[model samples]
Target: MVGHVVRKRLYILVFAALIGLTALTTGVAFIDLGKWNTLAALAIAVSKASLVVLFFMHLRWSSGLMRMVLLAAFVWFAILVALTLSDEFTRQWTPVPSSWQAQVQQQAR
Candidate 1:
């Protein structure tokens, strides 16, 4: 079976990109971004995944249908990630009652 022959230069470039992105991801890990830390890491991860999929998997030379399917899958993944993060961010927000005010009133009386 015949296929597209990827050039060595392209391979080297992709490898470099993967390495650099990995370094960036590692550096970002030590920094405290608070709530944005997870998002930042995920963004870097998606870029790395894209590089692997497009070059290593040869998806870049594939047909439009294949690309469209991948795009749809990415969209679904994004939706799921967004929903998960939303839940995570809201998890700390528990509803507080007026119990503290009642205690203050009793102390004053």
Candidate 2:
């Protein structure tokens, strides 16, 4: 049986890239970009994950059926995350009335 062979040099390069991306993620964590920080961190994380999956996981040399399955999995994950985030972001949290607060305090005691 024939098998696919990955070169050592390519593996080393991918390893270096993953390490560099990790450093970038850590560096970005120290800076306060407010809302943009999450987006930046997620982008870097996705990049790193992609590199690992493509090289180390051998997805790059995989068959079309395997790629299709992986794509479906990613789509499902995105859908779930989107639904959860939408529900969380759309909720309205209203403050409780003073009477209710008093009742809560009395109940606690």
Highest lDDT model number: 2
Q: 1-109 in candidate 1: lDDT tens per residue?
A: 7788999999999999999999999999999999999999989998999999999999999989999999999899989989999999888776777689898999999
The window of 10 residues in a row where model 1 has the poorest summed lDDT is 90-99
Q: Highest TM-score: which candidate?
A: 2
lDDT of each: 0.95, 0.95
TM-scores for candidates 1 onward, in order: 0.70, 0.84
lDDT of 2 by residue, 37-78 (tens): 999999999999999999999999989999999999999999
lDDT, candidate 1, equals 0.95
What clash pairs does model 2 have? none
lDDT of 2: 0.95
Q: State candidate 2's TM-score.
A: 0.84
